[model samples]
Target chain A: MSIVRRLGLTFGLPIILLAAWWFASANSTDFFFPPLSEILTALKDEWFGPRLLADVVPSVLRLLAGYAVAVVVAVTLGVVIGTSRTVRATLEPVLEFFRAIPPPVLVPIFLLLFGIGDGMKIIVIAFGCMWPILLNTVEGVRAVDSVLSDTARTYRITGTARLRTLVLPAASPQIYAGLRQGLSVAIILMVISELFAASNGLGFAVVQAQRSFAIAETWAGMLMLGLLGFLLAMLFKLVENRQLAWYHGLRRAQRSS
Target chain B: MLDVRGIKKVYEGKGRTVEAVRDLTFTVDQGEMVCIVGPSGSGKTTLLKIMSGLLDPTAGEVLIEGKKVDGPPPGMAVVFQEYGRSLFPWMTVRENVELPLKQKKLPNARRKELVDESLSAVGLAEAHTAYPWQLSGGMQQRVAIARAVAYEPQVLLMDEPFAAVDAQTRADLEDLIRDIWHRFQVTTLFVTHDIDEAVYLGQRVLILSSSPTVVRQDLAIDLPDERDQLNTRSSPRFAELRAQVYSQIHRPKADAAEPVGAGATAVDGGASGYGAAPDLP
Candidate 1:
């Protein structure tokens, strides 16, 4: 019975939200406050109609490029730092200090260093996406069972072979967790970067519409960004599910116990 | 053959020092199986760790075939008490068994053959592709055993390898170890706290005194080489040996009123024999 109610809640909650918004905005006087229906119409007619693919493609490409770079750099460094006690000890404070600083706050510095371009935005996104991945990778590698390490040593598995065969696989669940978190941050920073400085992308489109007081168009752009974030998060979940099927099974078993 | 002489281990921490084992000595002849038993914290594990070259004794040396064991020797393999962690979860059972063979740089074909044979020897042929987490505790321990055997080491060291399993499984594993030891003729040094397990599986049992341990008694099992779990354990000889080892381990020290028997006298006569029984208050 609880399961059935949960299912209803999952399906019904969103509809209720849309209904409430639609009713509230039905009699609004402010031009900035567009109805949900108006926003949807603008989204369908302008955002997803003829120029749909072109507007979304560049933003997605930038996000992917930044995300890929973040994953590679963060994972490599994270593994190194995690595997060596001395390295971890030397670098952990620096990493924590950097992680505490918000990436958006670096926009002015990045603009100064790299200039106002896609390069700046990419750098920002990469920087934003890196911390979660790096921290999680370190944790994952450290959390690898000591007994497995002993077994590997007993087999005389050392150096690259040990890292490749034992450490990587053992640390994958945590690494994947890091990747998911990093990807989410990447999406957030991608929009944030574009909103702050970029000439193109969804953030630029939203800002442009808002300056002209094209409220519906502004809402449509915001809606698209929200949808993109949701979609990317869902995509990450799919990847995580496929990659961490065994981890999920183990979790289920643990929960049952 | 493996020889450990005057092995002493002292652990110093937080301004306090623990003498885990002191002046312990023992030897395992080629193809002979020996079991070391003592109370918890009596350094049974520390002794095994030193023997396997996982730890260096604070004083003394472990020699395998007359060569000093400074690090994990290629000729010796170890099975730990925690079966769940010993076998790599990411690798299939066959892969786990074959890993050492790979390290030995054996040909792929020979590695495959050894893995198959070892898995079958441990009754895990069908479980070759199963991950360690997919199997029962006993089966996982069997994979660990299979891994050790597949390495084809000259000596196998087990530290309470069956302690995590159920009674039925523990008995089965004890028999399995004996069978494998006999079949392969590999020198095996098994350490356990269970007296019955030590007597059941060992050609000779070396009982150690408590902390700062030393050998209390070295009892040779008179049981036949060929053993069945039921028949051997049910025999009168098995009971006598078990009782003998039990008494040696549990004898009260302050109550010196009882006239010391030959066995008691042997344990008490020499500082070398009884040393200091584990510091069990």
Candidate 2:
């Protein structure tokens, strides 16, 4: 599709959604079913208010910290396990076992250990995010073309130099793919952890507003969380595009032909 | 210089051991261009890999300048058939060419000069900043060639480097390789299944027999050293050399129904047709 047509299609769905939401709430009598206008007012009030900023800042900080930790640990472990058959064999089963366990299921355990503080939330987010990045990294490293590796070897490139120049760069596109996947997971777990146990953050605000029967306030919180996730994802995509510019160009050329 | 003596390769698969190469022996002198040609499954690639130090021979040793080659040698470089995979997609042409120079620890100025010279020689100076995927198949192969040449290795091994390109591009690449070979005077060993390419590119071509391969005949190209695709292909000598290789390759299969001695005689006569050229040391 043309760029303009794609843009129209994107806006088309949101327009339909807004219309449905407006129509449904217009005839409702319950105070919980506020109109779209009231919900918008609440969103503006909450977003522009001090409480909203405070919650956003803490939530963003935790997310960033968890993501950074996940990236470092997963990439390091992925490279080691990916390149060594013995390490992969020994760790595969254990990694699979851990990966299959849902991050929310471990919240009680983390809560006990870290005591329901920011530490517990961060740990939960990190645990949830690490798998995709680690597995993708392993696939990326293993997917490096053998011929390129041989060429590097032929040029006397070995050890750390080989990893840095050949293996890592060759594997980066896939690693970035993993990062994108991991980032989405991290966002989901961040909200889940905060909603389930946190005293602050957007998720906690949503739960608080819901309990108070302030439907507009709850809708505003949900809207803010959705916007945050979208923005974070967009930011990650921007970084990925910059980092993988060459790979994207190649893909474009491949598709065009 | 490279010497391969009693080289053997046996691949163990499932429950059987398949002999890929057996007791192969040959030597390439300094500054010589030697081509190895054989039918499919005749282990030409296996021998090239062993010679290039990419693979170890099961029974014998490969020596470069009288030194045993147990691994990739410092003075040797290889250009593989799949140029697309051999060149890093993430690296620009200049960076790809400069990588080996970096490995050699060459000074930046020297490395830059060598890279520029090699790229210019291959007519890719304008493409220095372009990534491999941005170039055509033949252009990518040129980058691969430029990379190997920029390394300034004492010996270069190419395994059917032009096999993946179009006929026109293959011709251009062939000429480019010949020009580089002449200019650099680096000892080159080229392996190809194409008889014409083998005769056209090499000063000498080694024909190998069928499975459990051995050198059947080593023929020297008596045609003038300078070559052009149109002029050389039109030459009577080129046709005679190609015809001789064809007979050698097809002789065993065609004579299979003949008496054993008769088939052997046909093979001997075919070998002698191209073997009349003066030998290299």
Candidate 3:
């Protein structure tokens, strides 16, 4: 498909809906349901200049830091637990107990423990994202093909070489599945964590607008959050396609054949 | 050189005990191609696994170059039947072939030469950049062969490597194996269920029995070294030798007392002795 057609297919409905809102709300007088034009103007006036650096940059950095820590910690622990039957058996119930508890509940506890700062929010984000990637990595490592394992063994591909060549790549597709799930979860928890006792962030800005009754600014903040989510999702898809090109191609070939 | 001495394997499950391989013994000397053929469920795979050090035997051991094989000795390489699963899908053909050499810690120049030579030897130099899944079944199997060949091991083990490909591809791969064996002079121990494949590939064919699996007949294939799919397979000698192996596979253990006929296993019409007759006076 051509780039124009693909873009039209993707954005056509959203554009139409935005246009409808633009025309429909042109003369809106309700405080909560402000005009789209007013919201756009409010978005630029409130967030486009000073807040972009002070609020948005810091929020994005914290999200990424938490996400990176979660990925590294989870994958490391998952490979260990998955590769060994004893470790998996020993930790499975404990992990299950922890995983059953809702992630949001930890935020207030984290607040009490770490106090209101970047540390608490980062921990909350990491804790929320850890479950999916960790479990998927464990599952993926466990499900590495027996033939491939045997081939690795017979070739004397041991230690780091075996892990690098066989274990990681073999389990990567499933790992990516977990990673993808964790990303949206991380985004959600980032906002949720920011909502409580956060002095600066996109979430803080939105809640702040709501508290002071700046209705159009509040709507504009929500729009920015949605736009941020969409852009981040697109960025994630580009990385995944690059990292797992071979996997996608392999599946496509298998499916067609 | 490889020696499989008195290998026995028994599976102790939750409810039952099953004997997979019982007192199996064989030897494949350096630069020799020996094929092991057995009936279905005869533990051919179990024996290969034991020899390759991928699995442990209840008794006995495998020795390569006089060193015992306990944990997949560095001197050995295996070409598995499931080519799709054996070759890493994430890596291109060149990467798959170069992986073992990386383990061996060879220099980049040496590694590249080995990978290039092996790929071309298997008629797959052009497909070096292609991933295993991008190729046909036969081509995938060729990549597996190239990987094994690049390892430059003393003993090469193949467990029905051509079983997944079509007949024509099977024939072509069989020739490829022979060519590699001739070129590299790597000691190859092949295990297969196909009788004709066994007869065609090996200098010596070992027929294995079912149940408590044991060697039934250690027949010697007396065809010319420069054999082809058409000429050698159509030869009378190949037919006679193939028939002997076929009957031996079907024969039960209870009728083991009768000695094989004078011309049963080798049927050497060309020479007096060609390494087939073991109990000759």
Candidate 4:
């Protein structure tokens, strides 16, 4: 389909749903179903107000910190494990066990150990997101073309140059996939950690609003969280595009002919 | 410029040991282009890898400019057959060519000049900013050659570099290598299974026996240096040289050196009427 029609098809359903919700909920008296207009007002006042400073900012910061930690640890460990057979074989089983456990299940353990502070929450988020990045990076590194490795050796590209120019770029496509997967996992763990025990954060605000029966405020918090996730994803995609422009170009050229 | 002294390679396969190369010894003088041709399983790659220090021989050693080669020697570059796998797909043409220059610690200005010079030599000046996968098969191979040439190695090793491309592209690449070889005055050891290519592109053609390989013949190519796709290949001397190389590659081997193991598929070809192996002395 043409790009314009494709865009229309993509956005058409969401626009229609928003229009229906606005019209249907315009005059509703239901306690649970607040009017869309009232929801928007609450979103502006609550999300765009001091609450954003007190909640959303901290939450975003925690997510970024945790995600950054996961990336660093996973990439470093992945390269080590991927390149060395002995290391991989030794740690494979234990790493698998850790990866198999769901991130949410570790929340209580972290809460007990770190005591419900930002430290505990950030650790939980990092632990949850690290597995995919680690495994994918290992896969990418192991899958690096043998010929390219030989080329590096022949060129005498030793030390940091070997890692920076040859190994990293060669495995970057798989690494990017891992990063995207880790982002979603980080976001999930972010909310779960905050929801269990947290004074501030979007998740905690939503839970607090629901408990206090401020339904419109709860909707606003949910709306803000959804938008945050969407924006973060879009931002990740932009970075991916910039970092992997050559990879995408190659894929597109391959697809075209 | 390069010497391989009594090299032997024994691969320890699962539950068996296979001798790939045996007592292979040869030399290529400075500024000479030599091609090694053999039957499919004759261990040409093993020999090249050993010579380039990518692999160690079970016995013997290689010397480049009289220096013992235990690792990739400083003044050598190799162009492998699998261009798809050899060139970094993520890097642009310029970056791929520039990689080794950077490794060599050339200043940025000098590296840029060499990259540009080599790319244009390979007719890829317009493609410096393009990725390998964005180019055609032949173009990718050109990038590989440009990379090797850009590094300005004293000895260039190419292992069946044109075996993957179509016939037409292969011809263009053969000429490209010849042009670069002449322009740079670099000693080249090119490996190929194609008899015509071996005869057409080399100053000397080294023929190897089948498995447990040994050098069977080292024939000087007496063709004029100025060669073209039409005239050089169609020359009477070209036909005779190709057939002679063809028969040596196909000659029956002793029972002990029988073609075997992984490269067995390439054992049988050139069965059509060709000259018999030159009277063995």
Instruction: Please give the range of 10 consecutive residues that has the lowest summed lDDT in model 2 chain A.
Output: A45-54
Q: On a 0 to 100 scale, what is the lDDT of residue A186 in model 3? A: 92
DockQ-based ranking: 3, 4, 2, 1
Please say which candidate is ahead in lDDT: 2 or 4.
Answer: 4
lDDT of 2 by residue, A195-235 (tens): 77788877777788899988998888888888888888888
Candidate 4 lDDT, A47-118, residue by residue in tens: 989898999999999999999999999999999999899999999999999999998999988888999889
Candidate 3: where is the Cα deviation over 4 Å?
B256-281
By TM-score, the best candidate is 3
DockQ of each: 0.46, 0.63, 0.80, 0.66
TM-score of each model, in listed order:
0.89, 0.92, 0.95, 0.92
Tell me the TM-score of model 3.
0.95
lDDT of 4: 0.87
* CAPRI class assigned to model 3: medium
CA deviation > 4 Å runs, candidate 1: A1-10, A19-30, A49-53, A255-257, B252-281
> Rounded to one decimal, what is candidate 1's iRMSD?
1.7
Write out fnat for all predictions, comma-separated: 0.40, 0.79, 0.96, 0.90
TM-score of 4: 0.92
RMSD of 3: 3.7
Interface RMSD of each: 1.7, 1.0, 0.8, 1.2
Local accuracy of candidate 1 as per-residue lDDT tens digits, B44-153 = 98898888777889998877777888888888899999997787666778888888788789999999999999999999879877767778889989999988998988
Report the Cα lDDT for residue A116, model 3: 98
lDDT, residue B137, model 1: 86
The better candidate by DockQ, 2 or 4, is 4
